[model samples]
Target: MSTKQENIKQLIEEYMKVNQMGPGDRLPSETALSQSFRVSRTTLRGAIRQLESEGKLLVKHGSGTFATCPLPSIPSSLDRLYSIGDMIRSAGLREDEQLESIQRISVCPPDIAEQMRFSENEPMIALERTRTANGEAVAHSINWMPEKLAGPILEGDSFSGSLFQSLEFKAGVRIVGAYSELTVPNYDDAHMTRLLKDPQATVLLLKQLHYDEMNRQVLYSLDYVRSDIFRFWVRRTR
Candidate 1:
């Protein structure tokens, strides 16, 4: 979170604490709080807007802001197993996955097998998802599922949630580990023009192979996450 947002959040928490506000308690007027804190109304409003979005506060017309119900606890994000939802949730943004295609068809390109480690021309479920953060399209993903085991799942909108999550909860395939390789590629002019806002922004690509608990190969994925929206680092301790 940005420092400004963090400071505003802290102020709200303190207000809630000192006032002993409980659920359904009406918060002070925005003007009152902004004046009391000697901050611009815009900053105070930004804090409240985020709080409202996160379910901490609710605004009323001609009335006053009040606390609504709190959200149920959700598990913290972790490594080893990951999902699109986990990525967005941990980043303090909402997640939505819109399917582009899901169908079992003959491989148009035989080289997919070399990437997926399957025999040439084997059937596979090709699924594409346009990932959104804060409801804005941020990434594009493609994954291949082995055909025979995938059954009906390969043909339709089975993407009610994360593919990895659904694989475990529905298909009994537990994802134990995976490896990823990153590359900076020449931007796809057509795709980047629409997505990156800046034509010169580069694209970050990750090609990954996922394995099951039984150590069997299950999936191969290609993720195109925009470089600007993501910042990554590695830490090595001496």
Candidate 2:
């Protein structure tokens, strides 16, 4: 989380504490909180949603959000794997997908080829997109898959939703699992800074190798996530 977001979260917690808000107490209106904190509505909403994710708040549609009594045990986001669309919805925001580019290529980049275990110069399909949550850009993803899996995708009318879902629906290739590494990305990178439009924002760079049901590495992806709007977690078990 960014410093601004953390500060907002802390501020809210203090308000709850000072007000002696019991479990099931209603929070102040969004406008009120935004004005009180002198933050934009967007940032305030993000902080509220983060609290809800932590089981500190309960949002009831058609009803006001409430403080949870005894705060429910927030499930680990790591426990149940999710697609990008799922992640947005879980954060209580609407998801919008923008397809930037899609094409077939004969020459694979050396790094990508190594990850996919493909021979260099082999043909493949590239899918590029930007995902927004509630109209705020949240992630940019570029994916590479073998040409054989591209048939059904190419014949489709729209590729605007989940690429993993489309690949499964069209080609019968399911993304059963993935091995992912997360790191803080260089915001100074010219292209990424321009695309995301936040040169100083902290972001998560997720490099993942998606596997099929048979445990074959069938897809490779690079995803850049805006940390303020999205949070990724891991669960450790004995």
Candidate 3:
């Protein structure tokens, strides 16, 4: 969270505390809160989302936001990497379906090439897909990989399972680890909004760079996760 978000969160909490708010109590309107805190609606919404993710606020669509008792969340440890399918399964929801598009690009995007350590002219494969659990879309992902490494699998018709598994089996490379960063995207994407089936949805953006056992960057992915459906946490020690 950014400093402004943190400050807004603190202010909201204090407002609830000072008002003797409890479960089932409704908070002030968005306009009211924004004016009271002197922050933009976007910033206010972000803070509300942060609080909602922590089980401190309940946002009932078409209704007002309300105070709520802490609710159980699907806990994901930050120490390990899990495929989107695996994460859905672990949440006890059936990994129902995926809609995908794949293409071979002659030139890689500069930023992606830089991250994956590819030469400017190196070809790559791009995969974009939306993953659903129990009939509800939970994540949208775009992945890029060196063509030399993933071309074989892309050429085959049996590429219906996890990308991680496909790379290990067909591509013959084991992805041992990944570096991931999480953030709340500040802008709304029309395509993503439609895919997730919610125009006002709060989304968490996760960027990951996966490496093989040889420590060579093999894949880079951008995953947009629905905050209402998933939550992740990291342990910190002093």
Candidate 4:
């Protein structure tokens, strides 16, 4: 790809982002895009062809070009445990985080404490963040851990995206497994809808109890995943 083609591709992606274009959204006509970008038709077509080859755009004869899904749907297996960041990376998307939500020291609630095998009033470091893939919100996560294990994270600025990575590298704790429960949520949350950028989005709630190598429960988490962007499956042998 020449520099001009790459630049044009980036511009087209930006245009899609700005317009909130999702799968099946049609792009402007080639002439219109060429005129808007001030580029010749040949260059614009080159960029479009590249995007089409990459499965980001689809060109149908006589039907025009349309945007494919901006991010690939993650097909996760139920037999294994994966961090949010790991899942996003496996889907060939850039994993990013936005910590604009709550991250603070708080007392663990009774139900969560019981799940973590901690006292009801146990001190915990609670973190709530929106996980993004290629700058698009994909999941919202809320995690609670005993303050003793994750206390330093609250005071430091080392957290980039993955809490699992941060825990292993910073706190010397490695999560080996988890007990998970998955469900489809029937309630509407305006806050989550706004963050996900889709008012009609369906959400899958995943609740997990994480255990370390020592077989000690260390973390409890609630992950609200955008069902449209992620697909979870399990293999069954009869």
- Estimated TM-score per prediction? 0.61, 0.66, 0.68, 0.68
In model 4, where do residues sit more than 4 Å from their true spots?
1-69
Report clash pairs, candidate 1. none
All candidates' lDDT scores? 0.69, 0.75, 0.82, 0.82
Better of 1 and 4 by lDDT: 4
Lowest summed lDDT across 10 adjacent residues in model 1 is found at: 71-80
Residue pairs with clashing backbones, model 3: none
Model 1 bad stretches (over 4 Å): 1-81, 152-158, 189-194
| Per-residue lDDT over 97-147 for candidate 3, one digit per residue giving the tens place of the 0 to 100 score | 564778778988899989988897999888888887777677888889988
Alpha-carbon RMSD, each predicted model: 8.2, 8.5, 7.2, 10.7
Residue-by-residue lDDT tens digits, candidate 4, 40-105: 999998898878755588888799999986567898998899998899999889899887554555
Count the clashes in each prediction. 0, 0, 0, 0
Per-residue CA lDDT of candidate 2, range 51-99, in tens? Answer: 7755577778668778864311112265455777777776667789888
Worst 10 residues of 2 by lDDT: 70-79
**Runs with alpha carbons beyond 4 Å of true place in candidate 3:** 1-73, 155-158, 195-199
Q: The CA-based lDDT of model 4 is what?
A: 0.82
Cα distance off (Å), candidate 2, residue 53: 20
